[model samples]
Target: MKKLISLLLNRLTLVLLLILAQFIVLVWLINFFSNSWQNIQIALMVLSLLMVLYILTRNDNPEFKLAWVIPILAFPIFGGFFYLFFRAQNLNMKTRNHLYNVVKERQYILSQNIDYGLKGNYKKIETFLESDFWPSYKHTNSIFLPSGESKLKVLLEDLKKAEKFIFMEYFIITKSKMWDEILEVLIEKQKQGVEIRIMYDDFGSATKLPLGYYKKLRALGFKVISFNTLKVHLNFAMNYRDHRKIVVIDNKIGYTGGINIGDEYTNSTKTFGHWHDAAIKIEGDAVWTLTILFLENWRFSTKEKISYEDYYLDYKVEKPNGLYVPFGDLPLDKNHMAKDIYLSLISEANESIYISTPYLILDNEMVTALKLAAKSGIDVNIVIPGIPDKKMVYMVSESYVPELLLAGVKVYKYKPGFIHSKIIVVDRKVAMIGTSNLDYRSLYLHFENNIFLYDASSIIDMVDYFIETIADSVLITPQEMKKRNIFYRVIQTILRAFSPLL
Candidate 1:
């Protein structure tokens, strides 16, 4: 009870309340004038028409365009204004161009000289290479981490060996057991003259960490940034959050996946019962890609020029593993990079597809691709949480279950607790593990990161782990979904309609 009250009184709470108050006032004023003034009503109607026409021509998901069109027609007076208010970028034009320039300069990483005999997967890999400007590496060693606890153990051990610098970026980080242990190691390493840089999404950490948290971290002799700080304003820029989880040490080793720096991730607080998550470590040649991913974002946030050559190191791993491609999905980019990779994987898989994700709010393209894969007699399985972290998102997931089940796609609910991992293993030969969920937000809205790996021995271990998790899950039959009453189904349908916005 005390904690609840304290949270309610936090600065984030106060700022949110202020934003809500402003929104309500704006809506009230618009509604009042639209009813009273003939000129105002006509102007708003014209605005609504223009908005609908503009939305129709956008090169985005058709479903997303339909989602917006519904509201614009229903509340013609306020809907267009609301759309403009939310879609407008808060950042100035100069800043936007600078962000673009930084990424543009890193385009060289998209091409690599070293090649491999990836016989039939050239088209699948080329999407990341040409579209997103991410290279596929040939000589990197990777190890699969099955759980957050496992990642933490390996991460702490690796952090202790940081010789030059450590770059850490995540969507969420709170003051907790997991963070404390990592911070202790980081502090000791900083004292030893190892450079430390930390970046996290401000909206994700706003309530958990105090205001100006980065300033506090800087005081402790670390370079830190609270990316996209939460402001009491209406802007779509806040929706484009940095949802990537990365830990790059000395440009020699890197770690990434669904895990975050929170006690719940490590199952210490059990915020969502037994929290299930995963992360993987890449050592040798490919770690450089992870390092570059961090440095690009770090430069964008900090506005500091980085000597790319200074961080370059030719790492050598004994008994090196298979091909690895670490890439990030930029919300600002025209192409839906991660979603395309997922589609290629589903379309190319000849045997089976195993997936575990916390959210399953997919776009039409993904849904169709999955259904086709299942209909082709391929073993298709998706494991979601029995206990969800977000009920609305969970219901949105449940809304898709009926159609998916009918199409022969098997869906399972993990019985133990909320499974936060985002992983896809195809044909026991290729896998993708990372922070991008099987949801609209991860696919189209948030900045996300994931690794595309092929022919890695760890792929088998990941598949085995997914199979073990399926054993602990309950399969959702078609008849089982029929048990939901009318009211429950209606609510789910409503959530699904606006899911793209979420």
Candidate 2:
């Protein structure tokens, strides 16, 4: 009973309940209006028909479109107007105009500076450049930090060393030991007169952080923006979030990965047995790209004018060999660059593709790609958490397992605890590590960033780390997947069907 009360008192639970109640009220109003007047009913039906027609002709993803179309057609009275009120994709683009504009303009300049020197025709690199306008650079050095604990230590060290300026952007930030430690460094740096700017997603940190947390940080003389500050609104615009985690120090060093600013990330106070995650510390010219990514987002959040050249520094290692491409994906556009990038990596892998993600709610294209890769004799291996942080999400991830296991794609459940690492190593020749997960949220809805390493030394570390992780994980056969009860399987299927919306 105490456990039940605690769950009910949870901030996340309260917020979800409020949102559900609001949606119910909205549906009731729509029904009431339509039933009260024949003309209103006729108008709503026509509106529903028009919306269905428009959705069919949209150039969006097929699955995403279908998810909306079904409800609108089924309940013509409420669905059409509710979708009208809650259609967040268009709302997101409309509301975040400055953010989108800044991203595009900065990306244009960054693309022009690409120095892909003799990195002959790897279409995947070209895919990022031509499509996303994110450039590839040589003379960049990378160090792969295999766990969040290692990453936190190095991050603090780097933060303390910031001489000129520091920039940090994260999806979530809670008042925990991890944030306290980082805040201590920032406060010291603030006293030293170093420029510090921090941004955290308002929706992502809504439950994790106390209200007006940004105001508190600002009071300490550090510039901060609560990205897309959540307000009471029926619009679906709040669904889009800035999920990118970045830390740029003096344009010389940059860090990004699955880790967020919370104790669970570093296992200081474990929510699930142990929180295992990966992050990358990239030093040199590639750091410039990360710097641009942060600055552009910061500029949008504050409407603060920045002389882009003032932030540029000649920070690059001397005569480095391999290629490094730091890129990002914004969900406002029709292009699903992150998903395409993942598919490209999977398709190009000759020997093996090793993946580790906390979530595995995949769309059809991704599912087909993984299955096809396994059938084509590619060693496709995946690792998910053994102990889940969210049981429903874990179940949705499990729903994809049996089909993959049947197709010869090896699946492993990490035995230690929940693994939050978002990593993919392809044949030891290329690798991608960053904020992207194998789920729809990372690939479709959220703003995310990642680095592509081609023949870079860091790929070896990523590959080696995967080798170590899988060794500690439990491999499951088709028979093992079948052990799930029928009732449990039904719930997993139902959750998965609405995954796109989730």
Candidate 3:
């Protein structure tokens, strides 16, 4: 009973209920006036026509434009009003301006540490990344962890060596064996006068942690903040989330990838069948790039000014013979650089392109790019999970398989369990591993981060891991997809039509 009451009184739940109530009242008012007066009907029609014109002229994704147009055109009476109210309630110019200034200042500090001499093909990649202020480094040594258990062991060992500060930002942080062990070390480190700060997404950890958990951490002498707290009001800014998983230790070591702070990521908890994930541990000057990324978001979340040089490490290490570039993407940015990076890899592949993602809901541009790459006889392949965590999303993922197979792209599903790794390897020469999935939210609407490797030794290991993972997957053929029932096809079409919103 207490649990139910707590859930009912939750801030997120209350806000959702209030929005629903307003929607119901709006619908009733519209219907009553439309039936009793002609002037109301004419006004609604004119408002909807203006909205359609605005949507058509805006520079947005085609899929998203279609999703909004269909509903507004089909039901003009209520749709236009709803769209206006939703847009007007969430104007966050202050937050956006603050974040822009923080990024501009940090990027200037990071550009000063870039290494200029590039080898063969790395020169092209370096030039491309630098066009957007993402600098490439040559002093970082990267370790590729093929599984969550391996990553956890190495992370715990690295946390013991922190002397200055620890900065952690993740989408989700649950109270599980994984977090409990790490928390113990953090508490002990606090006693030694080490600075520790954490930031997490409120919506991502809504059900896992209590309402006042950040306060509890503050009481324990740790600086913590919840990103974008949920309140009882009408707001659309909640849709934008912090999805990047980053950890920086003393500005000397950094980690980023698909794994989160939970037992499910380690396969210790069986939410789905054998969970598979990956992470990258980088040690060297490249860590400074990730440190800047974290501090930018930290400043936005806490409204605190941080001196970039205070956390910067000036010592040198044995420089590795490769190029490592770490970059971040923001939803408000016009570039949409994550999708551009993936498209560049696809377009530049000479022999093969391999990708692994948990979800495969893609827009038309991505679909066309994949199809073209495969039709060029370039051995394009993708691996997704056979055991799903979200049924609707899995259906939408499967809906794209048939079209891809018809275009000569090969698709595989891991037979053992869920594969939560987000990776892309091109021609076994360039590779990326990070938090961005191959879906709309990751590509277009969330803050994401990834590391690009040019001639790094980890590329060999990543290729080998991809081959091993493919061996355990089941291939899907066009003929097999054709055998699905008609009703299933209809449902798939419906889901695909609305995938932009998903």
Model 1: lDDT equals 0.86
Which numbered prediction scores highest in TM-score against the true structure? 1
The number of residue pairs in model 3 that clash at the backbone is 0
Q: Please write out the lDDT profile of model 1 over residues 1-502, one tens digit for every residue.
A: 9799878876678777887898888778867776577888788889999999999999888888988999999999878887887765577778788889888867665355234344335445654454556766777889999998999999999999999999999999998899989999999999999999999998888777876778878988999998877776665335778999999998889999999898898888878778888889999888887888888888888789898768887778887888888888888777777788789889988999999999999888899999999999999999999899899899999999999999999999999999999999999998889888998888988888889888889998899899899999999999899999999999999889989887
Off by over 4 Å in 1: 27-36, 109-123, 126-131, 234-237
Q: lDDT tens digits, residues 29-89, model 3?
A: 8777766668887787789888888888988898988877888899997567656665333
lDDT of 2 by residue, 26-62 (tens): 6687678865778877788899998899888988778
Q: Which candidate order results from sorting by TM-score in descending order?
A: 1, 3, 2
Mind sharing the TM-score for model 1? 0.96
Relative to the unseen true structure, what is the C-alpha lDDT of residue 321 in candidate 3, on a scale of 0 to 100? 51
Q: Per model, how many backbone clashes are there?
A: 0, 0, 0
> CA lDDT, every prediction?
0.86, 0.84, 0.85
Tell me each candidate's TM-score. Answer: 0.96, 0.92, 0.95
Worst 10 residues of 1 by lDDT: 113-122
In angstroms, the error of model 3 at 225 is 0.9
The local lDDT score (0 to 100) that residue 89 gets in candidate 1 is: 58
